[model samples]
Target: MDLNLRKAILSNISENDHKQLEATIVDAIQDGEEKMLPGLGVLFELIWEQSDDQDKQEMIKSLEQGVQQANTGS
Candidate 1:
């Protein structure tokens, strides 16, 4: 949440991309209870849309590990 990190994330984005991201984020935040869920939805959609087979495999593996950790009370 640092300013530097925010700037870094925006560094490669176009103006249009920035506008879209800002709108989506603001909408998500205004929803409050489910705030941020939409942003995560967008991220997951992008990952699945753009990732190669190996990338998806790694993502699945990581998620499985996370599930295991959560189930084990970590």
Candidate 2:
């Protein structure tokens, strides 16, 4: 069976309110389970698609900073 993971993930969370969506992300990150990564990636994909260029640039900057911080443990 072929699984459309992005569609499946979006379908599951489509009804979530803003707070619920935030909680879902927080909980998933806190849980730190490998299974949650795909859902997060799908969510980020949705955000990236919806973001304007400025928003995307800001997100990229934030992510770059975060990755650097994580790598340097600072």
Top model by lDDT, which number?
A: 2
Candidate 2 global lDDT: 0.97
Question: Which regions of candidate 1 deviate over 4 angstroms?
Answer: 1-33
In order of appearance, the predictions have TM-scores of 0.54, 0.95
- Candidates in order have lDDT scores of 0.67, 0.97
Q: Which residue pairs does candidate 1 place in steric collision?
A: none
Query: In model 2, which regions exceed 4 Å deviation?
Result: none
1-74, model 1: which lDDT tens digit per residue? 34563344435333547678767666666877564664456556666889999999999999999999989999
lDDT of 2 by residue, 1-74 (tens): 99999899999999999999999999999999999999999989989999999999999999999999999999
